[model samples]
Target: MSRFFQRLTFVLAATIFAALGLGFALGEFGMFGVHAGGEQDGAYRQMHVYAEVLKRIQSDYVTDPNINTVTTGALHGLLESLDADSSYLTPTEYKIYKNRPTTGVAQIGLIVSKRYGYATIVSVIPGSPADREHLADGDVIESIGDTSTRELSLAVIRLMLEGKTGSTLSLSVVRPRKPDPDKITLTRTVVSPPALSEQQYENSSILYLKPGELTAARVDELAAKIKAAGKTRKILLDLRDVSEGDADQGIRVANFFINQGTLAVLEGQKFPRQTFSADPSKFLTSAPVAVLVNRGTYGAAELAADAVEDAKRGDVVGERTFGEGSVQKTIEMPDGSALLLTVAKYEGPDGKKIQDEAVAPTVIVSQNTDDDIDADNPQPKQGDEILNKALALLKAKNS
Candidate 1:
């Protein structure tokens, strides 16, 4: 009788172990033998159920649905469930998004935002299409052709505003300064969005380098330009709107200014914190520098700013930066669809987290009401106020 009881107990234990193993396999690898419990398990179950539903519809539906469309929709729905920012990008959109910083395309040369249900221009590019149209800052973009910008997403508004070179967009604008607040139409033209546009201040030897995208080549080009100018007493590096880029490029760029110290550190789940530093010999360590940043400066841009500030290469000026210090790697699937997976979190040279908390400038300048404008002709009253402030700081440092 005792031997019989032992045999029964052994059988029960073996069954439980097999069930647990099966559950783990299904949960982790989606083998679909057994199921687990908890949120992750539920997510897996839902995915499995969705697959089954798709298979059923393909086999027994009244009419066959487009498989590609169904698959795309499913993926989109999955991403949307994760978060608003998480979305699938097609091959074309993915290429455009990834190469913007490197190739210098997709820049409309203006800072815009959605305000009070209207697409209002926050600031105009100094020499951009809107600036050339005499679009002063403080214009309210009422519509684009027949389409009202009311409640339009910033992405849609941007698509409306941007097009291939020579493509024109008609905008209805409401300018406060004009005698009559009427709709003004404007044409979109290809403006050279320079990686670095330099201007010498009238009275001081301060050189303002408004870097749109801080590439390694651009940084080198900027340094050469400043060197050729030969009289720049101070440098102002404008990093507003600059986002992520190649880490190798970022490292090379940082080497141009920093004289041998830790540039930034990247830490992830799989690997320990990797420290990147500048080579001592390659430092562009002469001039007193001031960095200009705003909420749009993120990722590689923020990393560069942090490196400069931490190494004492320059003082950071302007408004707080957009805290996006997480590092994402582009994972390409067998299909054209790709996933930008956030794999790691990084810190500036000063060991500060730039994820949720934006990097505060040494001199904090608030965005004034006069800084906003219309889309077609976004000429803010005090346009490029942040840039102007950076220039002022550079001049002061030189003086």
Candidate 2:
């Protein structure tokens, strides 16, 4: 038993030293933008601090601690500190990620991201399990089944939520109105993307289009609708609850309205800056436009909202969008663990990184109009305030 303890201590020390060396090398390569020798020295000092902390933990802890578990958690924290999208996948987690099915995967229909060191719901697809359970944007998921989300990487949290059809996922959720966490069980199902909904308001003068997902096909449908509307009807794009879809498709949707100027820019330490300019040929709409957004709007939807707002092309109405726009590069470690690092981030036309600073609405309107919630009447009041506000703004605009 004493020999086992000594072996464990030696292993922990070696792991810590290895991590320190990797950190130093990354700093030397300007990964963290530390080019100065003074910064390098400071980094080395921090590494020693880490070593001291590990030594104290092994020597003074009341009970025998799992050194391997501690090391794994440290690596998870190291990657997560960079961004919500970047994650550290352990060997087992990486194996699952690599073997995850391309199609026929079941899910509860929640778009999730890490915020405040916990897994947060970005959006719940309409008619899906999560939406049916009344989960809303900004809701914090404290744990999944027996595991706390704080100890799990963002990649693992996402994987845990998906499984074979009919599989059950248990969750402890913290809602804004509820003080205590709610325990819920969800059965995973294949959630189909909501179809593009089009409606004409104000005697068909304002064309309202709501796309639940920003796929290439959806954007193509949007273009077809705009072209078919002719020169009479104005556009009111509803991007609320849009969290899924390809990022490039979202940029293409922006080009439908913006004929000129820089739409978005991608840049990183090693990645060359690439500017995405609007193509005049893709510009299908010259009519007055307004875009609706909410906390559920993320990734590609953020790109569209930011483009419109920055181009001064339309009024962006509703709450600030959920920020999420970055490209990740997967790096596999020698031990079979992997790192998903943010290689580049997308910036709005105004030079603001969408992932850092989410798109703010030009016209701010709360999704909930009710100032107080009645316990007896838990059901929300009828009518969408965000849509109404956007329509009002579009009604006042000239074609």
Candidate 3:
């Protein structure tokens, strides 16, 4: 009887030990129900499952599937499930995205956005394929080749639009003014957007500086030119349709006016709030300034507008800006893919949160007509209405 009890105890101990060993091995090798403990375990588990599913499909699927297509589809699904903003960028796509803000690539010279399930033409670059094709502002992109852009994500649409410099792609767009609401096809071409354009208004003291995608260095050069042009007392910094880029460059541009004070603040999770200040030495002009912003102004452009507004140095004009106040940090994956994660939120100098509610212009101006919508080919005489209004305010203040 004693021998039988001892045998039973030994067998039970062996069974318990074997189970523990199996659990550890499964957890370590990333198999079975056990999990390798960590904050990113969830993400890892998903990735592992994705890989296994891919393997299963490739090995035993009834029909032959293209690996590239399968991977892209899986990645797209994964990103879509995460959030609208989060996305998986392939190696080639990631490279292009990284260079988009810094480098001007082969583009059709058009500013576009997806609105109400359609790609809306916001601004047309003068002399570009879209402009040359007679594609006017407010045109809706219906389809790209056979693929409808209605259900496509913004990133995918942008990728499809961009290709090799000389390559061409068919774009089916809908013009509001056309008699029929049918799609109009256009070919793609290489186009560069102009940085700066200036003109003297008929009845205002304001010199309008329309800089589109102009680098901060280019803005500084233009500032010198503006100063050298004449003794202009007040200036209009038109940031309509301007997207965000290098914040440091924005700070430099803002420093030209702000003598001293905080420019903007960055608040991040697990990180301290960091304040960016303007140096007094970089003041370009002490003249009263007015900044013009529309719903299109965002990112670094919004930051610059906020800095100018916060310092009480300029009166913001036009409509409210597009509030994209989140900071994205790019993380590269092992396969050369990239993930752009929103790491922080930005605040204006006056402690205004700029995430959802954008900075509103003091003087509200609306773009109602086709002429008002066209930023490239403004009406020969009446394009600078917003600037003129701002200049009038400045003149009144001086008077």
Top-scoring candidate (TM-score): 2
Question: How far does residue 328 in candidate 2 sit from its true spot (Å)?
Answer: 0.8
C-alpha RMSD (angstroms) for model 1: 10.9
Q: Give TM per candidate.
A: 0.59, 0.89, 0.70
Q: Score residue 131 of candidate 1 by CA lDDT.
A: 71
Model 1, residue pairs in steric clash? 135-377, 135-379, 136-379, 137-379, 137-380, 138-372, 138-373, 139-373, 139-374
Q: Write the per-residue lDDT of candidate 3 for residues 300-346, one digit (tens) a residue.
A: 77888888988888889888876667665556764576655556778
lDDT of 1: 0.59
- In candidate 2 the C-alpha lDDT for residue 237 amounts to 90
Q: Select the stronger candidate by lDDT from 1 and 3.
A: 3
Return the candidate ranking by lDDT, descending. Answer: 2, 3, 1
Q: To one decimal, what is the Cα RMSD in angstroms of model 2 from the true structure?
A: 5.3
User: In model 2, what lDDT does residue 285 have?
Assistant: 81
State each model's C-alpha RMSD to the native: 10.9, 5.3, 9.9
Using lDDT as the yardstick, the better of models 2 and 3 is: 2
- Tell me the spans in candidate 2 whose CA falls farther than 4 Å from its real position: 1-39, 369-382
Please provide, for model 2 over 71-190, each residue's C-alpha lDDT reduced to its tens digit, 9 standing for 90 to 100: 788778877888998887888999999999988889999999999999999988777899789888899999999899998989999999999899999999999978999999999999
* Clash numbers, per candidate: 9, 0, 1
lDDT of 1 by residue, 209-287 (tens): 6555666667668668656655446766667656535555555666666777788888866547888878766665477
